[model samples]
Target: MLNKVLIIGRLTSDPTLRYLPSGTKVVEFGLAYNRRYTVGEQQREESHFFDVKAYGKMAEGLGARLSKGYMVIVEGRLVQDRWTDKDGKAQSRVRILAESIRVINKPRTEEAPEELSEEIPSEEVPPEGPFDMEDEIPF
Candidate 1:
């Protein structure tokens, strides 16, 4: 069985870095993911919110570089947090335990002015069409 999860989305809020009593570093943030799909002739889109956290050195690095609205790629595994609620009932929720994080977009400081358009080479963009499932991914 596999439990790995990979997600690319925008940060809904700035990352918060904290230190545990044991001196372990951790960072937590919210991510907003959007998906678009075609149902028959109708196109539909939806947004999903996720709670994500990173630990140790990765958390320190991400906390310094990431901010609200930044696009990032997170690779990790799902963890179920189980505990007793205030009502004394058992509760559980799933969250991502980030093993790695990569910033997808350029940092805000280096971005060109909004009025300027950056032209990307045609080859840089993937063509829109059907794909063979058996084909090896270029990446």
Candidate 2:
């Protein structure tokens, strides 16, 4: 049996980055996913929130750049933790242990294209020439 999950959604808020006692970096974020379905007569939509966590370098880079409304793709496994609450009730939460994350889309803005230009010899552009097809039938 395989246990894996993939999700594509927008960040609900900026990722929070923290470190453990041994300085192990961890980042936590929530994703807002929406799905549309048709009911008996009308169309309906619902939004779901998923908790995600990234570790080490992935956590550091993702935490710095990810912000609210950013779209991302996450792949990971499921993890659940159980604990007792103040009411003497057992509470459990399932979170994702993200193995990898990739940005899916960028919001529209007036930003220039990122050009990675390298120094190269510039050649003169060739002049345009008119096409001549007079030979016979000028259709």
Candidate 3:
């Protein structure tokens, strides 16, 4: 069985970070994604919302770096939390358990430099150089 999910979306609100009784770090946030489609010569847009969670180091990092309106790419798996409600009814909802996350864009703010909004982290960027067929492929 395979349970993998990948999504790119904007954060709906600032991430909330917490720690479990065992001292495990956790973060939770909401993500919104937009979908565009054409129907009968008309263009329509739809939005989807999802609850996302991350654990440990990933959770701590994301909690500090992410904010409302930040665009991010999340890779993880689907998780369904099940429990009993107050009325003795069974309830369940699905959410993403993020394994990794990457910030693609940051929301414009007065305190931030304009150029920094779209800049990718130096470590994730490839070195600039002319392509050479003779060079061995890093991959």
Candidate 4:
């Protein structure tokens, strides 16, 4: 069986970081994704909101970096929490248990400082010159 999910979305609000009694770090945040589609000559846009959680080093790292309106890529699995409410009715909701997160863009706020909005390097660009077989690759 395979249980994996990948989503690219913007943060709905600042991340909340906390620690359990055992001192394990945990971070929770809300993510919003937009979907656009055309149906019978009409265009429609839909937005989805999700609750995301991360643990340990990843959670600690994101706790300091993530904020409202920051675009990010979340890779993780789905989790469902089930319980009975005060009304004696069962309640459940699904959320993402983030294993990894990548910030793809800065926050939309104009007041963000240039340094704070600096792009996080995603991948190293190859050299401009043509590759030479004899040249050693810097792996």
Residues 1-139 of candidate 4: C-alpha lDDT, one tens digit per residue: 6778899999999999987665667678999999999999999999999999777777777878778988888878787666567777888778787867878777766675343333222222222334324322221
Model 1, runs deviating above 4 Å: 106-139
List the candidate 3 regions with Cα displacement exceeding 4 Å: 108-139
TM value for model 4:
0.76
lDDT by residue (2-112, candidate 1, tens digit) is 778899898999999987666667678999899999999999999999999776777777778778987778877787666567777887667787866767774356656
Q: Quick one: best lDDT, which candidate? A: 4
**Reference-based TM-score of each model:** 0.74, 0.73, 0.78, 0.76
The number of clashing residue pairs in model 1 is 0
Who is ahead in TM-score, 1 or 4?
A: 4
Find the candidate with the highest TM-score and give its number. 3
RMSD of 2: 24.0
* Residues 1-139, model 3: lDDT tens digits: 7888899998999999987666767688999999999999999999999999777777777777779988888877787666567777888778787867878778766776233233222222112233223322221
Error of 1 at 59 (Å): 0.7
Residue 117 in model 4: lDDT: 36
Cα lDDT for residue 55, candidate 2: 68
lDDT of candidates 1 onward, in order = 0.70, 0.68, 0.73, 0.73
